[model samples]
Target: MRIVGDGTRALNFFIDTLLVFLLAYAGFKTWNFYVMYWGYPAYNFGWFFFGILFVYYTFFELVFGRTPAKWFTYSKVVTAKGSRPALWQILVRSLVRLTIVDMFFIPFFGKPLHDKLSGTVLIEI
Candidate 1:
């Protein structure tokens, strides 16, 4: 498998971020409906959005070894030995993604903090 470049990584980030936003919007709508139905006060979804972001990556990567963005980019996450990463690695990756500026590390650090901390790499299929 070939390691992807920054361009592919950027594409993946864009697509994934879009998807996450859409998901959060849908979730907010549904939640608002239920809250109104129960006559409860409206609430902000900032924390909920973060939760969705974490779950999105964790669920997709844990189950399929990639996110929808990764699938579209023809890439998958793998360990240093070129195998599927373990559950712990996927979780670590997802958690690190919530840091908000982890992507900034790519230029100077080569890989993002998520990839380094998780011991995972994105490889082209």
Candidate 2:
């Protein structure tokens, strides 16, 4: 099924990656952690990042259907059924994103694919 959304998910990826990094750096600087990994001073900051992103994406994607970055890319999250996500739905979506299980694989299927597998969507808007 050719999902007619976000023709430039590729471009969104590139832009979003840089934006996340920059935001992370800003977070670090704001916290006065020059030695931190861009605002992550904890040793297990991977988990911290996971946790934070979980909250951010879950909360926003559920309430607003997009993160700040997704908004910048003209994309919004949705359920696979093309409806607004519920709490559990958003939780599941955040889990997929936080784990990076989707981005971790070959064929390089990003958020949209993971959302599809998890019965969610990232629509162009």
**Candidate 1 pairs with clashing backbones:** none
10 residues in a row with least lDDT, candidate 2? 40-49
Candidate 2 lDDT, 24-106, residue by residue in tens: 55654555564454653543444444545666666777778777777777776666677777788777766766554565542
After superposition on all CA atoms, how large is the RMSD of candidate 1? Answer: 1.3
Instruction: Encode model 1's per-residue lDDT on 34-66: one tens digit a residue.
Output: 898987677788866888999999999999998
**Clash totals in order:** 0, 1
Among these predicted structures, which one has the highest lDDT? 1
Q: What is the C-alpha local distance difference test score of each model?
A: 0.91, 0.62
